[model samples]
Target: MLQTLDIEHRLKSTLDEFVADWGLDAEITAETWLVEDLGFDSIDVIQFIVAVETAFDKRNVGFQELIMQDGRYVDDLSVGQMATFLEARLPAA
Candidate 1:
């Protein structure tokens, strides 16, 4: 199984690529907020989700549960939060 730190590092790398691909001028870290820091909209979030899935070589990681609560989309998410969620769902490696 991948350790928590491993997942965080990998996720951060993926985010770095996403930021570059979008031509975003920002530094990514565990505390970086997707919406507040990156200025990501809903469509951007969906695209990022796909990018993350491709980077990790996995799909259906239940991002809905992470992005939604009480039938409403959450306002924002930090990189660390996403790493934790992905760590739990990704299979052993």
Candidate 2:
């Protein structure tokens, strides 16, 4: 039974690994913006969503949609936001 904080930690670690695997030179933190700060394009955003899903063992979570508005990717997607999203999906401990 993983707690929310535990899940969040795992998510952060997963994001770190994901970015490293992509060869992006950016500091990952709860406040780091996925696009502006990390330089993620649309394709990168899609792949990021996939990474989140895979890390959390979820499928079709539509993570990209959360950070989009009017069919455009939002410039802000912090690591904290991703953790919160995954936290909501986690079962109560």
TM-score of each prediction: 0.91, 0.75
Off-target runs (Cα >4 Å) in candidate 1 are: 21-23
Report the alpha-carbon TM-score of model 2 versus the true structure: 0.75
User: Tens-digit lDDT track for model 1 on 1-93?
Assistant: 578898888888988877786778887888999999999999989998998999889999999999999999999999999988988899998
lDDT of 2 by residue, 1-93 (tens): 456578768877877887786677776777788888878888877887888778778797667567777998677777878777767665554
How many collisions per candidate? 0, 0
Consecutive 10-residue window with the lowest summed lDDT within model 2: 84-93
Give the lDDT of residue 73 in candidate 1.
96
Total residue pair clashes for candidate 1: 0
Scored by TM-score, the top model is: 1
lDDT of each: 0.90, 0.75
**Candidate 2 global CA lDDT score:** 0.75
